[model samples]
Target chain A: SQQGEEDPQALSIQEGENATMNCSYKTSINNLQWYRQNSGRGLVHLILIRSNEREKHSGRLRVTLDTSKKSSSLLITASRAADTASYFCATPRGKLIFGQGTTLQVKP
Target chain B: EPEVTQTPSHQVTQMGQEVILRCVPISNHLYFYWYRQILGQKVEFLVSFYNNEISEKSEIFDDQFSVERPDGSNFTLKIRSTKLEDSAMYFCASSEDSPNGYTFGSGTRLTVV
Candidate 1:
């Protein structure tokens, strides 16, 4: 299926703390993308890291890809209460296969 | 920033009835996809469309399911006969290419009664 599995199914942290979530997949991928979904809403694209790139960053989000390990991680620095959402990693084959996702709660 | 737009934010239909979820992907995007998420469950892929035809689909996209790009900008998903399990939030997304980031619509909550 090439679906990514995310670690720490749920996480809770105080505002201003960093939150890190990891994802592992079974097959080779063209690129890995991170998406955040607010409760009952649609997914919002976070970042995309190509297989050849080891790391990429967008604003407060940093994503690292380890092709050898077949895993990736997303780090959000100084998370705000608004950061509370479910995060998913997707591997786009013909269609995008998403992970189960990590639910984050950033308390203010 | 352009966004994917979905109509009829919520729809309630009786079992065995047909339902058509509509979306208008961002203009100039080539890849369009449909995904669904049941309450408290993971998002699942259903189908992908490109160049006016389906490029790929999941097992869940059965014969009862179909997609169409009736015009230059609108995409639609039709379920011939919806079941109770068909109740979910249907999301439409589009990407410029296979490796690009996707823009998703707010979704249409389909309630099959």
Candidate 2:
């Protein structure tokens, strides 16, 4: 499959804890993007890390990419109940191919 | 903040019927794309349009699928004849340029009964 694969299919954490999800792809990519989606809703773009960049941070969200490993990770620090969502990692080379997604459950 | 908007959050149609999913991408964006995700499946790229033409499309996008900007705004995806397999959430997205992040619409839930 020409798709990125995500690890730990699911993650559960308590409020104030940290959550991390990993994504691995088979091919080289120009950039990798992270998105969050509530059940049955459209996806919300969280962040994007280019091939040249190693890490990026947006408020509480942090993303790290390792081109050598063809993998990336998204970290949500001090997670909140509202942060509970299915997080997907996508590799965009012309078009974006998404992974099965990691369901993050933040318990209050 | 601006958002990508899709219409008819849910649509139910008979198999073999035609359905058009509409999306209004964020203004000032130059590229548009359509993607679909079946229940419990990963999101799959369908097609990408730019400069009034299709810049790229996937193998899944056969003759049955078509996309058009039809107007200045409104980017649309039309399934000529829907099938049971066509039941999925169709998402519309836009990006400013190459390697930029995409803004996606909530998606139009298409149910082929």
Q: Write the per-residue lDDT of candidate 1 for residues B1-113, one digit (tens) a residue.
A: 99999988999999999999999999989999999999988899999998888998989999999999998989999999999999999999998976587899999999999
Give the poorly placed runs of model 2, Cα more than 4 Å off: none
Single-chain TM-score of chain A, each candidate? 0.98, 0.96
**What fraction of the reference interface contacts is present in each model, in order?**
0.77, 0.87
Enumerate residue pairs that collide in model 2.
Answer: A42-B106
lDDT per residue for candidate 2 within A1-108, as digits (tens), equals 665788889999999999999999999888899999999999998998999999999999999999999999999999999999899998887788899999999999
**Candidate 2 chain B worst ten-residue window by lDDT:** B95-104
Best by DockQ: 2
Global Cα lDDT for candidate 1: 0.94
Error of 2 at B84 (Å): 0.8
